[model samples]
Target: MAEMKTLTAAARSGTGKGAARSVRREGRIPGVIYGGGDAPEPIALDYRELNKLIYAGHFLTTIFELEVDGAKQRVIPRDYQLDPVKDQPLHVDFLRLKAGATLRVDVPVHFINQETCPGIKKGGLLNIVRHSVEMRVPADAIPDAIVADLGKLEINESLHISAVPLPDGCKPTQRDRDFTIASIAPPIAAPEEPGAAAAAAAAGKGGKGAPAAKAAPAAKAAPKPKK
Candidate 1:
């Protein structure tokens, strides 16, 4: 489960583009906390502190205890915007977490046991279909990732969502079909395809080994001198 962290913010009375720009000029990031039944609250966080947390990864999935005006509330980042050219954070939106509430999040997929997998041992490539799975889970007990085991997979065999165990209280939003997560793909050139790899390599060399076109029959030596 992802551990909740703490962040500090100052209450903001101002709103709109002009106000946000002013906040940025003062080395603070403009943001808002909404949802959970109460009205939206405007807030500002220290620029450097927020930037570090944003770049640390899993900013959206990780829950946070937001402290504003010395009062704390549980929340999770819903979205954020960045500058087009500079890539600096422009705005952020957070959602309040109510008791026993469930939140939808994209959890990362972690694969395991490649060393003992028969397909991998036989030179099969692990082709990942989904890097993450979107699921609804308890806000207080969000999972870190979904684990996919590759030990039982063979070449051309797939690992579906049903094959792996999901975290408790977490259910995938894709309930209609058992989606494929990963698979052991066969090698590009099978052993039966003799010289396929060699041919591909030669083709990469700009036709270096290819036979030249036979010179066109010499045009019959410019029509018979005997004529």
Candidate 2:
């Protein structure tokens, strides 16, 4: 298991959109921590630290140790809002967790060994249906990613969520029996003409061919008799 990252947070006394905007001006992100029968604590974090974790792409699955006023709290990111234009973290919601508690989280699915896939070698394309899967796991045992091996898969075949190997104590949260994760299919080919080229080639061979017999010419005397 990977180690959890620790971040510094401060309890905020103010609330509301204006207050949050003011906090952002000072390079802080406003957040809230709720769950586990405790009162929700409104907090603020340094923008630089939060940006680093967001950029790492592990904010959802990775456990975070939040230090609030010299007290340590274990939590996971539940929800967050991003600035539409700036693409920066606007606000975050953290759910407080306890040790040995079962938590549900979405884990990223990564495909491996595409170069060795027979389908891809035969001019087929790979399509991924689900990029991540939800699983129920202990808070401490959450996996970073679920790997799917595509080396043995042939064209039109797929691997489902149930077929993936889960880490110890982690199971898929999906209710269905089989959920497709990825598949490969044959590539489409362009259409070609068959008859026009043959006719053009035959015409270029020769203009003259065998001729048939002519008819008799006995009607020429009737015109002179009328005159």
Candidate 3:
């Protein structure tokens, strides 16, 4: 399960563009918390602190104990937006968690025993089909990642979602059929260097069509100066 994190936010009084812009001018990010049978609450987080956490990775999947004013709420980041030009956080949407609720999220895939993987040692490439998988998980028990074993996989063999074990009560979203997670692909032949084939053909023609070295017409015997 992913580790729990804590963050502090201040409740904002208003909503909409003007309010959000005003919050940003105060050097904080505007956000909202909704769901779990409650009215949405507008909130704000210190810009520097929010940027640090976002860069830490997996912010959406990581659960948080959010403290707004003096009260705490359990929540997860459902979504967030970034400025297209500046690439900075514009807003965040948090999903308030309630007891006995299940959530669908993309959990990262972790490959293990790669150094000893049969296919990799044999010059085969490990082609990843899915870096993360969406699964239905208990909100209180979300996993940080799922493991994919590669110790015994060989070239031309594929690893499917079924091969990896899931935590109890956790299920992949796709239940219809087994899906591929990764595969070991056969090595590809290196392409010949540019013009090498044509150069070889030219050299072969020269070998048969023209002598590499020609003897000068036998020099006429020195006309007998002696004769």
After superposition, which runs of candidate 3 have C-alpha atoms over 4 Å from their true positions? 193-227
* Residue-by-residue lDDT tens digits, candidate 2, 67-95: 99999989989988989998899999999
Compare the candidates by TM-score and give the number of the best one.
Answer: 3
Q: lDDT of all the models against the reference?
A: 0.94, 0.88, 0.93
Clashing pairs in 3: none
Please count the clashing residue pairs in each candidate, in the order shown: 0, 0, 0
What is the TM-score of each predicted model, taking all chains together? 0.83, 0.82, 0.85
Task: Give me the candidate number with maximum lDDT.
Answer: 1
lDDT winner between candidates 2 and 3: 3
lDDT (10s digit) by residue, model 1, range 86-193? 888999999999999999999999999999999989999999999999999999999999899999899999999998899899999999999999999887773646
List model 3 lDDT by residue over 1-227, tens digit each. 98889999999998999999999999999999999999999999999888888878989998999999999999999998888999889899999999999999999999998899999999999999999999999999999899999999999999999999999879999999999999999999899986898777777885553447866887677666773
lDDT of 3 at 109: 96
What's model 3's lDDT at 143?
94
What's the C-alpha lDDT at position 117 in model 3? 95
The weakest ten consecutive residues by lDDT in model 2 span 218-227
